[model samples]
Target chain A: MKDDLTDRILVVLSSVLMLTAVYMIFFYAPTERVMGIVQKIFYFHLPLAFMAFLSYFVAFVSGVLYLVKKDIKWDIIGSASVEIGVVFTTLVLITGSLWARPIWNTWWTWDPRLTSSLILWLIYVAYIILRMSVEQAERRATFCAVMAIVGFIDVPIVFLSARLWRTIHPVVIKSKSIDMEPAMISVLAISMAAFLLFWITLIRIRSRVDFMELRIRNLEKIKRGGME
Target chain B: MKNLTYLAAAYGIVWAGLFSYLWYILSKQNVLVGRIKALEGDD
Candidate 1:
């Protein structure tokens, strides 16, 4: 009951934050002098990327914990986090491409940052496929835990690709300065908070669903054994 | 008003993706709830 109440509160808080963020993005933030209206996408795009990275990091940590403790709950957390990470990353890519078309004159480019992000996406897709292929629950969990740990190596590379190499992708946060105005930064921060809350809410719901599935599986196994 | 279409598309895709995923999660939850209830009933 306590957990249910907390979840409800979180859902309400996140929804309110999301609506406020949208309003700030469309109305409160000032328009860019150069990019015009297309620049508005930055409010959503940057925050989605930040949340995606945070989600993957959570999955990576959960994966490590699962390996250390051999707990199915940790595996559930890792799985749920990765699923949410993939969704956010997909949004990041789509919003990015949409932002690019007006500015870069192309739908796709083989730039380092873009390529590394795509690789990150592909790696998680492979992780999901791997989990599906293995029939044994324990074995599947163990394998996925390992894969999550290994695949996390790509995340740093994705983040650093623009810095390490010359790339067309804009580096908003540079060594010396951030390339955004005060109002823009404020809107971005609010949007990030909203998305982060939403991410946590989704992960909680997903992990609960995973727990239910685990319970059902165990119950079915017991029933089969009793019949024998 | 220039580049309005791009802004609209970007926002559209973001909301569409998020809402679709939310719908997917809720639908799956509904199915799982039914199955769990059925299992409990059997027990």
Candidate 2:
């Protein structure tokens, strides 16, 4: 009961932070002289991309723990994080395309960064599909743990593609400096915090659902056996 | 102001995608809860 209350309070706090971040993006962040209004998309787009990577990293760690400990709880956390990460990555792709349409005058190009991000998204999609195809819970968890670890290899590639290859994507964080005004940087910091909170809340909710699902399935099996 | 449309589209897509996912998860949770309750009642 106390845990449920804490979850609810965190959800409310995250929603408030999200709304404030949106307001800051529109009103507080200074507009870029070159890009004008479209530059505001940077506030949300970059944060979403960061959160996606963070979530996937969490999934990777959870996957490793699951393999090492052979605990179903770790599997639940791994799967939940991946599910949330996929949603954030999809938004990252969509917002990136939208921002590009006006700036680059093209929706997409097969740049290394873009292509690698797409591949990362596809790999996680495969992860979910793999989970759906399996029946036995233990086998499903083992396969998914291994697949999550394998899929995580794409994350570093996606992060490094802009630097490692010739790409049209703008590198925001260089080796020594970030090229953004103070206002923009502040708003981005708040937005990233908001999104991180939102990610944690979603992961908690998702893991609970996964637990309930497993329990219901066990209950059904027990009932069937009793009837027989 | 020139690229305002693109900005709006980007923000709209982000919020809509998030809300839609939240709704989907909540709906699934509600269904599972109901089923669990029914099963418990039967037991």
Task: Give the top-scoring candidate (DockQ).
Answer: 2
Question: Could you give candidate 1's per-residue lDDT for residues A74-131 as a string of tens digits?
Answer: 9999999899989999998998898888899998999999999999999998999998
Worst 10 residues of 1 chain B by lDDT: B21-30
Interface RMSD of 1: 0.9
Superposed on the true chain A, the predicted chain A of model 1 yields a TM-score of 0.95
| Candidate 2 local lDDT, residue A132 | 97
Docking class of 1: medium
Give stretches of model 1 more than 4 Å off. A1-5
Residue-level lDDT for B19 in candidate 2: 74
Worst 10 residues of 1 chain A by lDDT: A1-10
Q: After the best TM-score superposition of candidate 1, give how far the Cα of residue A43 lies from its true spot, in angstroms.
A: 0.9
Best by lDDT: 2
In model 1, how large is the Cα lDDT of residue B9?
84
Any idea what lDDT model 1 has? Answer: 0.87
- Model 2 lDDT tens row, A1-228: 575687678778888998999899888888889888898888888889888898788889988999999999999999998999899999999999988898899999999999999999999999999999999888999999998899999999999999999998999888898888888888889988888888887887788899999999899999999999
Q: Against the native chain B, what TM-score does each candidate's chain B reach?
A: 0.93, 0.94
**Candidate 2 residue pairs in backbone clash:** none
Q: Which ten residues in a row have the lowest lDDT in candidate 2 chain A?
A: A1-10
